[model samples]
Target chain A: MDKGIDRRDFLKLIGIGGALIVMDTGRLAGAADNKMAQDTLSFIQLSDTHWGFNDPKINPDFAGTLRKAIAQINSMKSQPDFIIFSGDVTHTTDDPKERRRRMGEAREIIGGLRLKNVKMMPGEHDAGLDNGEAFQEYFGTTHYTFQQKDVNFIVVDNASDSTSSIGDTQLQWLSAEMEKLDKDSRIVVFTHRPLFELYPQWDWWTRDGAKAIDILMPYKNVVVFYGHIHQEHHHMTGHIAHHAARGMLFPLPAPGSVPKRVQIPWDNDQPYKGVGYRSAVPKKDAYGYDLTEFPIIKV
Target chain B: MTNIKYLLRIMVVISAVVLAFAWVHIARLAAETQTVQNPVANQGHEQVIKITVKRFDYTPNKIRLKKGVAVTLVFTSLDRTHGFNCPGLGVRTDIVPGKSNTLRIVPQKAGRYEFSCDVFCGDGHEDMSGEIIVED
Candidate 1:
């Protein structure tokens, strides 16, 4: 209870302290409020890395930029408990060997970080071949549920079909998972596609997102984070707050604003060049999430 | 008197005649069908605008024009797949590698319009964005 520490610093300290304590506790079960009193578990998100891309127009130092993101995350005075790579781990290609090579390289780079834990979800690019069997093989289960403190963290594989979709089986699994959670538990969901309709014409939305939303409606505190649009966007529906993160790669124009869905090329003369970052905090309001965003340019 | 030579000559003449006829037939088929028309070029007297989509950025990040003026956007993708989309103006076109895409849009109302690539081209794919400004 040091009064001198600022709020962010205090949170960071708590996060680091909590991670250490959790590591010692061995069992994360029933240690919620006790852990909260001593420390808080804060995690960092890195999305849409699209590794193995060698476009000189982006950054001949693309790998270097990724290393920068990792460095920034690691340099946080209070290290994050874990890191989640939201999606798009690699560029889309038909060659299986090429896909594996790209993913393997990305994994090696991320593994170089030596973090305690890392979680990932597949984007349309990663899941280009049906249910993302290759992605799952390289990574792990595409959809699964986990718990940290009193929060129920559900990572869903929405990039299951041609259009971003959480198949009926996944939906059923989601429904069953929610039934077991406590009424007061906070729910944080992650996916690679926007759960809400951003732009259907360009396939930016999940076809069965409304159904997934319906499943979470019973929860009082629900927050959903997705990465695909590659821009920072926040929307609220009932008790749920949906957020889309800026991509680590390039940015896309706002939906329906451009003549077509096309890549906005790079300009060398611009002051701000590459990468973006977003931070979110639980709002003071009973049901709200506040996000602060900024562009991370290469030097 | 020269039956073998005459027979060989006859075969060669027949082969040449067949090839000539086939060539004309193929040429006729090619001329009969019109190629895919450039959508923007079809709009006569429209204000022509050029848009270039390269690796990770758009050439004129912002486009400004007068309202109600017909716009003919001629776009080409320098690299992979790129999209030019303006939801407000109901314009969405995809530019593929080695192909040119064009669209004709007439904005009736004056406002700020945003455009972005829907394709995941590369690492910087998420940051690709541009804008169109329509004024009265």
Candidate 2:
């Protein structure tokens, strides 16, 4: 993957502030190399593991469910370039030590996957407990950006606050990051909560999401993949396509379809019903991606 | 003698009127404090607490249950999906619109237990929590 560009040059291009024109040149070059990067540019997303959650009626073996999900991803016909756990890595608790232990257990289980480049963001369950210290301890910065096949993947933490906001600091960083790219750059944003107002009554909307949306309005192709509602949903915010993924733990009722957010119960026969993940492939010479849903393998 | 008789008669009438007013006040107080047994508690379903969760709040957000009684929480969402997560009780349920979710819990200890919506349903998801108060 390392062409002639050294580490310094690569960093200088992707870096913000002083790194604008260089990034533009690199992006132009990236356009030519995108065809070769397309095949291996696909990635998998699994979310709402709720590792510490245990309930006989809903999901008794939460960890086991995640293992089966990993098995499914590992046994895929082709490996994805990376895997991203959108958020809610573990169920939040008042005990910080217990939360850390759950995070450790989740890491050990997720580590069993074949892919090495796994990135994670925090759902409210992981961040809202201790204000994201435990989550940051396991997974570095909650919000960050990386490039793969000319597509920029921006992962941010909006669950740190009960209001589901990206905070002023993260918002500033997001704007700065967006400034480094041209309007035509393919940007895929991964967040724990829906950036748009999916349903405010149920706390499905980000408090300060419009600010971030306003910043990205100038961009031609901005797709968002979020996990919180634990269902397969798609929305359009200007040019951006917001898609929410299914959870690994349990699925919830659709927005406005239910009065409260409750887990969908498993059938007597099919216990793993409605439990699944998704894989996405960024299209070449375009700003959108194709998504495919895969259900968890039955035990 | 006639004047004395008349004075006694007037005093008796006033006493009777005062007594009648006191009786009515007492009756009203009794009615106000009367514990109308929640029909849900007596359904022979062991334990049941029907909770209605809506966009911004949960109906009966403060539940007082008898300690050591097994309780089933019948949760329903009125607007959108809301989570009923009680970490202390190790109970979590989703209240979906148009349907009901049930959670069974037995409170062995008398204490305050808090629960909230774990799922992000909207901007107010954080404040969308309730508490269960158990009494001995």
Query: Number of the top candidate by DockQ?
Result: 1
Q: What's the true lDDT of residue B50 in model 2?
A: 80
Residue B122 local lDDT, model 1 = 43
Candidate 1 residue runs with Cα over 4 Å from true position: A1-38, A270-274, A281-285, A290-299, B1-136
Every candidate's lDDT: 0.70, 0.77
Model 2 misplacement above 4 A = A1-40, B1-136
What is candidate 2's lDDT per residue for A60-172, written digit by digit as tens? 66658999888655644356788999999898776889999999999999999877889998999888746789999998788899998678988878998654678899999
Count of clashing pairs, candidate 1:
42
Please give the DockQ score of every candidate, comma-separated.
0.08, 0.07
